[model samples]
Target: MSWDPYATLGLGRTATADDIRRAYRKLAKELHPDVRPGDKAAEERFKRATAAFNLLSDPALKSRYDRGEIDADGNERMAFGGGGPRPRQSARAGAGAGGFGGGPQGGPAGGADAFDLGDIFSDLFGPGFSGGGRGYGRMRGRDIRFTLDIDFLDAVNGAKRRVSLAEGRTLDVAIPAGVESGQVLRLKNQGGPGVQGGPSGDALVELNVRPHAFFRREGQDIHMDLNISLTEAVEGGRVQAPTPSGPVSLSIPAGSNTGKVLRLKGKGVGGQGDQFVRLLVMLPEVPDEELKRFVKKWPKRDQAPPRPS
Candidate 1:
């Protein structure tokens, strides 16, 4: 069947290189055999998409295809955009070295247009061809990319995660400390197998860090809002605060107010970054009668409340 690479990729001929790459990656993630195991329809779609990507991703091949010099399968097409077989020339005009007409002054046959049909055929047939054809050299396998979701704390501190791959294989990916969302971790020689003893491709794992309930990270620093009772804000005392490492005793200053950020050094990411705790003063859910009476008769201060730091 005649294949249209652009249609297979769901793109127009005017799509840019980046567009083609993105389209193929999206399709690969959805149609990969590993992703949709046992789905024969998806497997076939994956094969077709991969084949189209292989051809369209090559600038030389893509140019030739755009110019109608080659078919979708990379085979040479008939001259002048004709679908019929090429018209044969006279025996004398075609008879020469390897059946190619000689160039002017015996420079070279067909001049700049000359190319070895044997090499093109060899490329099509691959290295396994044993019918007196030169085999294509060893080639490194293509790299594979996939996304992995991890806990927020795992991203702050280094962690190892096991991921499954094609062919029932698994990989242990080491996530480094302070890894952010969209960061990639590459595992060498963990992707597709190489051809003809060539080196294998690498596996690229793109991380998606799950958000924490109370913690937010900025660079290496961690920030979180902690609720404190009004008495703790006014009288000051030791209170427990959460950090990326663990809970720690925090000394609240007297008269501390909301928006006051306290720094806990070496408690953020990998024990290198700091954790900032912002205090939010909270009132009692149900005020007692005695406290209400005391508040009703309390004198108003002449000075305004201090601004939070």
Candidate 2:
């Protein structure tokens, strides 16, 4: 029977990372082996819970599993199933893919339907291999895993990455939009060649998104501190701020203070998340004497109970 992590964890395809984590944690607490000693069902459920959580925890693995690229255990499934893309099977009586002429080892046995001893003997002592008490064909190719380092900006705004292989070959990986660090990008039929004409494997590329100096991400949301002038903060106006899409005008509230967060909707990763801009007042390196004088000479307000600043 095939394994479905979603079924094991009682989740759906639309489950997010947080939802997965929450579900796994709840199941682990309930199905913990220690809590139900000597219960085989509990132990098995516990093991399955762990496996499902581990598989679905990684964004890349979850994505691949959802797309049916890989199985619950991270093994690649034949993309073309049910006789799809099969190497030419031997349908001849004696003339296999590389078998001999239709006849026995004692020359060509006469008859339109002669008994092909070669076919019989080959089946007896042929190259067919078995595993776990079951006969099977040649093994499929092995998947190759690579860790690719990409720029923060490139990660935010997806870009194409060319990976150089040892055999003087290159692979083009299409980094998807809003792809996070540690997410996998699976390239189909790009790994080592198939064994004895079996299906080729895949190339699993794990993305390593470099961190930006001023910008950081949480899920799809992006956060950054915007340096607003004192004048801009005092007098609310439209101010331009740098975003992944480019510089965008943001309206700052009048009398805004430090630590105020302004939201720019649909400006984050792939424009699906909101960009949070924290207002930070930047002071000039050289103090303005005129400004200081104005403050010094300004009328003082009555000392009242300080409200929330």
Q: Rate the local accuracy (lDDT) of all candidates.
A: 0.63, 0.61
lDDT of 1 by residue, 1-309 (tens): 346879989999998877877787688668655557789788667656654665566665577669865545433343110112342121111111110111000111122332322333244444544223222123343444556778899999888877665325677888898899878787887754443344555666667788999999988889999999989999999998878777899999999999999999999888888999999999888878877887778787344676698
C-alpha RMSD of each candidate structure in angstroms: 19.4, 19.8
lDDT of 2 by residue, 153-216 (tens): 8888898867665334578888888898778788887764442344555677667787898999
Error of 2 at 13 (Å): 48
TM-score of each: 0.58, 0.56
The alpha-carbon lDDT assigned to residue 292 of candidate 1 equals 80
Score candidate 2 by lDDT.
Answer: 0.61
Which 10-residue window in model 1 sums to the lowest lDDT? 99-108
Report the error of model 2 at residue 290, Å: 1.3
TM-score of 2: 0.56
Worst 10 residues of 2 by lDDT: 97-106
Best by TM-score: 1
